[model samples]
Target: MSMDVTFLGTGSAYPSPCRGASAVVFRTEGDCWLFDCGEGTQTQFMKSPLKAGRITKIFITHLHGDHMFGLPGFLCTVSLQCGSNPTKQCVDIYGPVGLRDFVQRSLDISHSQLVFQYRVHELLPSHDQCPEGEFKDFLSLRRENSVDPEDQGRTIYENLEEGSYELVADEQFTVKAFKLFHRVPSFGFVIEERGRPGKLNMEKIKELGIQPGPICGKLKLGATVILDNGQKVSPCDVLGDPIPGRKVCILGDCSGIVAVGGAKLCYDADILIHEATLDDSQMDKAIERGHSTPKMAAEFSNLCRAKKLILTHFSQRYKPQELVTDGDEDITVLKTQAQSCVLFGQDVTLAEDFMTINIPIKKNN
Candidate 1:
């Protein structure tokens, strides 16, 4: 497992008494990224340990109200916090086309003055005739009709491995988006960390008479060093295998993973957060409505070789487990139905509001 993923909301379509909407936060020491911003998300931040002010990037899977209606309000709230305390930061957002207009219009209508700078990068569908890297500024939306969110066959990730749809990539990690089939144009996101340096063998270093200096540091950087005694020391002699990066997939409400094609982006993910909105008994209706059942989610997780599968975006009919204290975790029916579909004992977790999963880094020897 990895570090932390907190569910700010888990309900589908709308906010319920037990759940907010569709929102999740992935956080590390000095950064925070929000997956969705449903209504009351700011209030959810107040209730959870996640601070609202630290959101530097936001990824919206679609234009649905439940998935992004709160974005404008949350942005306003964050701006208010900064205005009062005087902190300067920028918020970068990514989503399907028309999202920028919606946000700008909402902000304009409300006249909410923000103390920070925020930019929305819209992901255009593959069929768009517009050339790559030549998209005019979002202000161009003012002169055109709204791009339909449910335009059939609309998708931004036609080629996942081309590295063209990357949203964030830095020294530590990368974030990319892939298409999803849904009632509305939807997407799934993957967060991948760069490989880390292998652990050093202290005993071997001591045996080689290597002191804690630039020599050891260069070895960690996979460079061979020659000692003052004219002996050659190789990195392989002291360093274990490099640690593979973690890959996490967070998806939007969808009927299924699209038809197989080029290399699958979600293959072998460390954690997969998928929407299992209905029970197996409602399989027919689930797909008709552009949703998935526990069995569907479990099968997808297995197909992708995901180490951990988290099922979320539950239907309102699935009430809390009887006599449960705060909320349902380890839901019985979901587990029972999904267990059969998950091969090789892949971990399955039923998501609840405020549920947090701590994942550890993968180690290699």
Candidate 2:
């Protein structure tokens, strides 16, 4: 299976005519996951190649206007298009505190109730506590009040109950979240596929005198059973060991937080999407604004040991043509050479809005 990541908006806090806000679509076969709905997101969707109805889950990074302003509009659009069919369908929404109230009030005042049902999971009172073991070494150094109250740090899955830690949705892939450092509680999500068992050898099945029926199903289901003739069959006898899945992480804004396990959260990601809102020249400005410069992004990528890094959430000051028109020698280099250098070492790419990146999957022997 292949995962496709398409950026809907790539601009930073300010709205540029060229880009909208922060939004990306993570797609696999029948599932479409949306990350952040900035202003004009619905309009952006209309222009994109994906179908709006395919979005089953929506994740909000923070309460920034640029990150969440488009939610109501998108919800309204869903109401207009979904109608009665969607009324039975529930769209699971995950966001920081006050998100449910904000969206609820917007719909209540506008009288634009969605035709589809939506269950909003608010990360209230924060859950950014680090996991036990090595993470404790990092969190011990952070100030007590430095954490965001609404930051649901590292939300792995959304359960029906608020404090439930059980796996809420079990599919072929697992989606895990971790906390990041920003003005508000922001989260980074890592989508990892579950290991898959080897395929059935059809020739061997026939050779074993097993008919092509539910018996084959038993093998694939990893079950051992006795045949009518008292024959024994086991999954291991037929299939090879399970293969590990690909890992990809998408993070919102942050300068790396020690409290939420910091760089460790992004470790070993096949593809890491770190926000690069500023250039190397503005490192001080980036720190003041609670954002990361491109060089910082590179440093974090290297520290996390990610296979590939993708820098996004660009400031409006940088234009697409400027990325090439001015060249690396230009006075106003939109992207820092340091950022490109890090990417070159790890095969990272600077992603653009509306671009779909396909991660190459290993072929099983």
Candidate 3:
């Protein structure tokens, strides 16, 4: 299976003529997971090949308007789509405290009814304070309350006062959330795909006088088979080494260095999607506003030894080619500066609206 990331909006704070605000979609296994839904994000979705209805989960970075203003509208659109089709699809939203209330208030005030049910999993600092293995039980509590109609929306916040819950876990992949250092409560997400079994060595099998038949299938399943000549063969004897999985780290708006937990979450990531809302010369301004500059983003990528870096959330002041009169350079200069800070020969690219990057599976050597 292939995993692809689509940048819906790449600008920061506000929408510009060439860029919108913060939003990206991670598509895999025919499901779409959205990160940040700033203003005009729904419109951007309409422009791209992605369907808003395919978005099963949304991870909001923070409560900032630039990061979440389009949420209510997008929810309404999805509700309308589900209403027309009458499906039993449910959308799960994960974010900091007040997210559920903000979404509920928006729907309530507009008197809009959703055809499909949606759940909001709020991440609290108390959850971060819990002991390591304790969060599993806390997550189980949240899951239990999900079935109760009265407790559906408010259960996670009310019941889990001192623990955090798992964002996502399945056979194919797992997603973990870590707190980010920002002006308000924020989060970063790390997605790790499960390692796949080794491939059957067809050349070796042919060498062993095995034909392309049921025995090959059995060998692929890690079974031992005996040939008609009484030769026993195990899968490990013919199979190659297992293929390692891919790691993707998507971070939210934050200052210079990520939190220790966040850094660990990003370690050795195949791709690092980070916010570069300011130029190198604006370090003080970035610190004051709790945002990262391009150089800082590059440095963070280096610290994590990320194989690829994609920078987003650019300030509106940066045009495609024009230099700023206030000492800030254009996007090209920013990209160049960020590349300089990255480890030698690593891939680094700036994210543009509607750009799609495919993460191909690596073959075992």
Best by TM-score: 1
TM-score of predicted structure 3: 0.84
TM-score of candidate 1 on Cα atoms, chains taken together: 0.86
Residues 258-284 of candidate 2 have per-residue lDDT tens digits of 342546646777888888787878788
- For candidate 1, the 10 contiguous residues with the lowest summed lDDT are 149-158
Better of 2 and 3 by lDDT: 3
Model 3's C-alpha root-mean-square deviation from the true structure amounts to: 5.5
Cα lDDT of model 3 by residue, 203-290, tens digit: 9998899998899989887789999889999989888998878898888888843346567667888889999888888889886777
Name the TM-score of candidate 2. Answer: 0.80
Candidate 3: global Cα-lDDT? 0.79
Considering lDDT, which of the candidate structures 1 and 3 is the better prediction for this target?
1
Q: Candidate 1 vs candidate 2: which has greater lDDT?
A: 1
The Cα local distance difference test for each model comes to 0.81, 0.71, 0.79
- Model 3 steric clash total: 2
Q: Which consecutive 10 residues in model 2 have the weakest lDDT in total?
A: 130-139
